[model samples]
Target chain A: MSNKKSSKVGGLNWAKLGTVAAEPATRACYDPTGVAITLEAKDEKASGGEGIVYTVPGKPGFLVKVYKRETLENPSKANAIRERIEAMCENRACQAMKGLAWPLMPVYGDASRKNLIGFAMRACKGMPFSSLFNGPASVKEKFPAWNRRQLAQTAVNFVKRVRLLAESNVLVNDFNPANFWVDEQCNVSFIDVDSFQIADRRGRPLVTHTYFASHTAPELLASPSALNRPRTVEHVAFSAALVAFQLLMCGYHPYSYQGVPDGGGCGSPDENLRAGRCPLGIGADCRLPDCWYKLWSQLTGKLKNAFITTFRNGHSAPAMRTPLGDLEFALNGLLITMAKDADPDRVSLNPCKVKSHEWIQTPAAPRSFMPRPAYPSRGFMRTPGFARPPYVPQQQYNPQGYGRFPTPRMGGTTSNFNPNLY
Target chain B: MNNNTNNNINNTLGNLDVMNPAPRCPVTILLDVSGSMSGQPISELNAAVAQFVRETQADEAASMSVELEIITFGSTADVVQPFTSMASVTPPAPFVAGGMTLMGAALSLAERDLAARRELYRAQGVSSYRPWIVLMTDGRPGDNWEPVAKRLRAEAERGKFMYIGVEIGNSADHATMCQILPTEPGPVKLQGLRFKQFFRWLSDSLKSVSASAVSDQDNIAYPSVASWADLA
Candidate 1:
């Protein structure tokens, strides 16, 4: 039991512990075409489980994603990744796409251009697509004054990009919303383009190892080798439809309802899809949040049918999923309708309505279908099973203010607070 | 529809509130605010907790899935904040530390609330990931904690929820903390006063958990805690 408060222990300074302070020794690197470039490690822009992204010092419009050392530990895997990126850079169609942060050049670990550590890509600017698919309050807070027309336009933009990728014989196997960014003007930019399954000029997939269960088709989820196989256009359609649906319906996952045939405890969204239970499907006895039901009802009949056909009929049959072109047309029609609306109040993707009962008539007790809990008021604490005593302010307490308290000084002692730890 | 019916619908819509429909991942934090944690410790803890909320809210997927609740035990255990969606959660008022360490009563209250929340999820057909209960304390328990600890350990063994014990400082009773936690991944001591780093790690872990596919839940690898924790 060491009661010593010293941040240093056994000649080790804990303040600098785990910090990657040592810069990479090799600064000069060559592109795939043997062009020499210098990389200055100023600061990391972002880091994730796979790699760290940094700005190319002289290249203002480009970002360099350096693979984490562990991610490229296997020689064979590293070769495969390099080859895939090289093929992508060489592809004319992939290079021509303006929406994607496509790999521009393969970056090497040294001047020999033998060790492919990462690649440089165009930098994308915008908030994550997931930000658009948030709760009403968050959406309103992030994009103030954004209406249904904007939502529809965002979906349309996403559809157009997906269609272009499909035309280029590429498949965005992973449909994670974080990988896509949407600007205020409803323009979408796709990131992580390196993870896409691209076909070579000979029509063979250069890279394929992706199956995100949440957005993947049920048939793919059932296959153990789904990751090794290239995703089809139909499969991509399902994912695209799901993303568009989330954007349009204000983040309601198509499979997020309760009360299916066997008491609705099917766990994850993937599991729900595997069980072929969907709230939008015909004869679905499930209970959705009232707002979801309202949003579903607010959608035009054709669009509703499209979603139903995709999530329900398309669950087992991939071909039944709505095509990206059809989805784009339907969204365009929606935007047109919104433009012709007489009242601005009704021009919201998330319509305010209380007619869920008319849509879903569950046999369960009506009380069970009540709206979800509201946000708790500020300063209202819920002390379960005990009466909260009246506030008796302690010493140095500020009742009227709520912010970071000024750091108090230690009398005749050195404090170990490091502001730059993160 | 008639004009009256349309007006009624409009009124209902006006009153109706929308919620994120993603699967729920409830995390309840049990903080010890005994007299021992008076000055710098409490301040660090407050700042760390506030940082954790901000980090979680910034993540799109985590904000939709994670529900946070906080329980503080001092003279008496009280739910300072109920289960709240990260999207809607406001940073709680700075906690004022004082009084005794009623660790047992707080654990009991946390267990009861978790069970109630699970029941609500089941009844509403809302799917949920494994819930998490984080018990953080600096001093020894002032009340009988053995019974609740035993039950909680048994529940943890049953895989109902994950119970993580964090020892705040050198004054924390490590032996008792170890006993309260499960066998594997036992109690970890906080490094110096790196509560901010610890909470950042926690926020990142919760984000991964919330984003994980159902099949990958068991294999979710948490980020390294060397920056914040002393496993030794």
Candidate 2:
């Protein structure tokens, strides 16, 4: 019998379809194209530090982000969002944003819908990027069929998105795990559209303040006015590499190590990241499973060189960072190699299988015990100049040497076959 | 004999080479199941603890790293469940309250258990985050709690672990609690039976802690206490 106890907790209760739904709050959103979009609220389950996310009743794949009453109180911030919406509406859709949750239109509370407070965008439909590192259970629950291979594919998708964004003259100022969602298919969507760095009407950067400490470039973090500085493509590449490391390495952060610092070495992950302490290079004290080390050893020299340059050799200099395209090429090659090794029928066969007998078989003739090159002694061997003395006839030629010394009386059990030869 | 000796040496070295310990975070829950908590409180506490376990088990990051234990204080303090992975923990059954609260003994046991687990982690060469101690009560301590309180204060001061004290209802002795718990944001008086919300916050905090490089204590971003409790 198990000693475990079952505790009673309330189970999830979803409203039945037959139940009447509550009257939803409705608003009309306008685009610069002179088209108006009506949005009816359904239910809100996701509340972030900035605003509450409500599902649109009519749109199955879209959601509306309404800024909290407090966030709109600041006029400058509100006007910046308004200008961003106008720009997005005027510009042609970028191809890189195919799988992203880009903003669609401006939303307002009043009937005129002229004052912009929130915007409508494609809703994120999967687990947050944090779930990748969360553990096997969470990954199993959220992305049932996803494995490390799938995770790497998701990371590759992220790299592709960043590359496209760069081509479109846009920058993801804040590229942390929390701002992205991934599905089981390795598809990715970027959230928090307001944080993207884009040009306003005056061609000035619309937003700043995206240096998340863990993923931020060391140079950016060291800058005195990091909040005001515009993020560069190098910064985006740095963050992307960090995410790639997690995806490929089962959620281990690039800087996580297992030893105490010596004099000037880094003592923590953040410190190690800032100090360029990569376990594959300067941070040799970091420990990983033997299999991971083996996998890393098999990587192409070019890929390994790129990792070293990005994380260890050129970590401090933003200009030395590997471009997203280069990283994608290396990762693609790695995935191919891993896939080849993952073939189910690839079994390694051992060549040796010789089972020894329980007892040794010695030679029939007594004189055969003498050591010879072709027949080495099976058990203990005597040293040179330490051979045993030979036996002589005990009886003085009494026809049969006293019948071989009367075949000495012994126990009933005796084997004629030698017991010391294979 | 030579082959046998070589085999023994190889076996020992292989064990060492294969040792790959994962980082763990130990959490000790010291609960008060006194006579005052017989009715709605015990049920709610049980439900909340169950929710905490379920949620932690669901979070892959927390499940892999977080270890949970439960120490209940009723007439006598006893560890209902020893330290185990959050993914494998059995939630506590609702207790029928009976005697005086042995909060001191429970805290003492919690401290010892947490210390022993930390040592075990060290012996296994597993890096670990600082542990967490959660004390919840609806009444005053039946035994003297000053000594254990001092030990806990020292532990918290050294950043050895995170300590949080919770008062269930109006019957709690706030004055004694303030003295017994860590003073840097001491005991919190729960707003009704918001145990689920409080545990949800705890689960989120631990999930974040497990996911990050949590060597610096200041890096922890606590979910706001205003959502569930107020400072005593």
Candidate 3:
């Protein structure tokens, strides 16, 4: 394998410390322009999925993505939806400048016809909210204490920004944690801007809702309504899920909340794990199963009336959920109440907990660990060090092969992901 | 029976005439993780995986339908991944580049995997083309590949599997690896660490397979794409 052109032809190979004549790790490069690229490996935060996170060579701290050279075969569907997103980014940047909305997405680049590649400012430097909130031993063990009042105010700030963007004709993904970045000052920035939309500027969504499957509201999943259906249902759900999760941190963790039934297999659970503190357990998967739907109905059985009759409960009518403006206001109000020298985390809220057998399985670690991005676990050039779990055997129904490794896009259920549809 | 229900669903998805459920190309990456392939080879192999992931992520057709699995032969020939969707497929666990290229065990693994995966397709009611197998290796098999090669040829002749051998590094003996496939366009060398490029060609070839309405041998496109242009 000593086919070296130079030591630093690309960037650092974590597997080998010195200048090794290693083969090119990736092959699907389509820079027909032959742009002189110099890949500089950045000191990435050691938490999230695996893969080599690189700042585009010439672009100067611009893009971060895993290349196609690895063995995992992921359909680059993002490239297709990205074209429309670039226009949205321009719209949002304009909005940010106009004081209409905050600019979260940055740029979109296409390499001729092969694939779409782009980058956003690393959304959050702190940690994935999922890891921080849920005590997943696979991720960080604890979240530092922040005053309830301060945290509530921060939540409101993000809500206000989201609401303003929604009013401007944008539908921020409520269920995707990978898209939301919680900064040092507690500022929330949304990445994956390709799916963003301009308020009232009409045409089908640049990014389809089916693509954002896991975070999909039961309403959208069950009914293929108007394209705008997801925007409405998801916006309200996002606000509630956020507030609900925040509530749990303060010790008054509600007993339960009403649940939404998903369309069968809407394929966006990574975001749920990345954004919503969702467990990657089988039941929590984006795929819809009759049993889990039944489980959900059982958990929130008492709140059936509120869910079906009242809009206050998001599960009420298929279309009715909390309004973005109301979410902004409630979060703001929650902030103010906590700011009154009282504990923000102490706010009272009713929980229609939908207890599931899945939650019972939580204390067990899911198959795969990437205390970092999904690609790097394979990229670290370390030994292929993993043994089958003593408890789980490999088979057709329960294949033990590659079950725990993050291979990035394998054949997933399309409750949300469809390369052509997206 | 449950099989009947599954067959109906399969028929609905791949409505091609022959209605073969097995993939037109059942590619197997016979990875050599023997002691001689330690450190760089093992790491390079992982990088190859990362590259393959990125390529397929862009391949629309293959990503949706192409079934993939990995079998590694070091001290033992282990089936790391069975035929699964690219969307859900996980990367094989990292290997320390230990043991011997138990080529025989690996081939046996591929033979069984192909037989079973094809059965799944038939039951699913999906239409598919003649299957293909890709054998990528870095060295001569410590376990003789002659019997496995003969068995692989039999499957190819029966319109079940197509085999291609790729030789990488000095540890690889092209003449020996070549015998594993049909005596057509001999085995290809992984020039200048081109594992990623070879996979690109492989995925692209599979994409063509997925897009085709027919599952016949003639319908599948391969040994053509620029990535595969190096085939000699």
Each model's iRMS? 9.5, 14.0, 18.4
| TM-score of each candidate structure, all chains considered together | 0.79, 0.71, 0.39
| Model 1 CA lDDT for position A48 | 62
Model 2, position B100, has a per-residue lDDT of 88
Q: In candidate 3 chain A, where is summed lDDT lowest over 10 consecutive residues?
A: A250-259
- Ranking of predictions according to TM-score: 1, 2, 3
True contacts kept of 3: 0.00
Question: Model 2: per-residue lDDT, tens digit, B136-187?
Answer: 9999988867888888877775666777777888889988887776555456
Best by TM-score: 1
RMSD of 2: 22.4
Q: DockQ order of candidates, best first?
A: 1, 2, 3
Name model 2 segments beyond 4 Å from true: A1-42, A112-114, A124-127, A135-149, A201-203, A262-268, A282-295, A339-422, B1-26, B55-66, B116-131, B157-160, B191-197, B200-232
Better of 1 and 3 by TM-score: 1
Model 2: per-residue Cα lDDT over A264-298, one tens digit each? 22244566676666565322445533443433444
lDDT of 3 at A267: 16
Better of 1 and 3 by lDDT: 1
Docking class of 1: incorrect
For each candidate, what's the DockQ? 0.12, 0.08, 0.03
Docking class of 2: incorrect
Residues B1-232, candidate 1: write the lDDT tens digits. 1111111212211111236556778899999988999999999999999999999998878987888878898888877777777767899999999999989888877777777677667666667888889999998888888988888888876666777778988999998887887654557689989999989988988998877765456656566667887855
Kept native contacts, as fractions per model, are 0.25, 0.05, 0.00
